[model samples]
Target: MEGFDFEKIEKWWVARVKDFFIGKPFKIKMDLSKSVRTLVRGVLSQAERRQKDAGGTAYVGAVMQHLVGAKLELFLDEALEHNGFSVADAPTKRNGDFQIENVVIHVTQTPTESLIQKCVDNLSSNLSPLIVTSHKGAISAENLADAENIADRIDVLEIEQFIATNILEISRFARESRKVTVEQLVEKYNAIIAAHETDPSLSLIIG
Candidate 1:
C-alpha cells in the first residue's frame, strides 16, 4: 500500500474519461457531387451527435477548432502552432486560436460577448479579428459585435464556408481535385488531434 502509484492511476482514469467523452472518429462519406460546404457541415453535425451521445461534455468546439487549424495549415502552406482544446486564449496569451500576418483567427462553436470584447481588443492592437463558428454562431457573433459597436471591425464567418472556400481554391476549382483536397485535410486533422489532444476519438475517418 505504501508504494501505491496514485498519480499513475489518476492519469489512467482521466484518459479513460476522455475516451468516453469522445467515443469514436465520426465517419464521413466523400461525394464529388456534394459541395465542400455541405461536406464540412456534415462533419460538424457528426461532432454534434457525438457530443450529445456523451451527455453534453462538449467536444464540438474542439472539433471545429482543430478542423480550422488543419485547413489553415494546408491552405497557407505552413505549420501553425497547436494547443489543446481546453486551453484558454487568456492563459496562453494567444491573440486568438491562430494568427497569420495581421489576421487573428478565433474558432468557436458558440460565440459569446466576451469573444466580442476580445475582437475589440484585437482591433485596438491593429490586428484584424476573424471569427470562425457555426452558421448560427455567426449570426450570434454579428449581433454581439453590433451590440458592442464593432460590427464593422470584426469579420464573422461560418466555419463550413471558411474551410470550403479555401479547399476549392487549393484544389484549383476542379471537382476531382476536391476529393484529394478533402483527403489531405482529414489526414492533417487527424495528425493535429494526435499531437495536441488526448482524445483519439476526436480523430476523423473518411469513408
Candidate 2:
C-alpha cells in the first residue's frame, strides 16, 4: 500500500502485534498521543473517565491538535492499512499517507486548497484517494463547493466513521485466521500488502 503509516514502520506497528484500540476512536487517538485535548475542545468530544483537566478547557488549539493527531494515528492508520490501501505519505507517511493499489489517503484536519490541489495532481497521476479530516463539524459551504468541484480528486472519509464501518471485518478476519487480536490481523494484512506490492508474482500466497 502506498500510504504506509510512518508509525507502522517506526513502532513495529505490524498491525496486530502492539496495536491498540479502545471502544471509541477518540479514546484510541488520545491514548496514542497521551492527551485528551480533543475530548475537551472538539465539537463532539467528551473526556474519558481518567482526565481531570478535560473539562472547561476545551476548544483551545491544543484540543484541535489532539483531535487531529488522534484521528490520524488511531483510526486513519488502522482502517486504511487494514484494507491494504496505500497512503500518500509513507516512510515519512505524514507527508501524505497510504496507497492501496489506486486508493490513497491524505490525512488532514481541514481541507486546504494546497492539499486539494495535491490530491488533484495525485489523482490525475492515477492515485485514487480520500481526505481524512479532523474537522468533526458539518462541512462548511466553501468546503462543500470545493469538495464537489473535485469530488473525484480524492475522497474524504471521517476517521471515526471509517473505524465503525470496518471494525467488523477486522474482527471477522481475526476470528477466521485464528489471529485472536486486531494486531495480528493487521500484521497479516500488511504483510500481504508488502508482499504483493513488492512482487505481484507473489500474489498466490497473499490469499
Q: Which candidate is the best by lDDT?
A: 1
For residue 11, give model 1's deviation from the true position in Å: 28
| Candidate 2 C-alpha RMSD relative to the actual structure | 16.0
Cα error, residue 15 of model 2, in Å, equals 36
Q: Write the per-residue lDDT of candidate 1 for residues 108-170, one digit (tens) a residue.
A: 999998898899999999999999998899999999999999998888998988999999999
Q: Which stretches of model 2 miss by more than 4 angstroms? A: 1-95, 135-148, 173-207
lDDT of 2 at 139: 58
Evaluated at residue 99, the lDDT of candidate 2 is 56
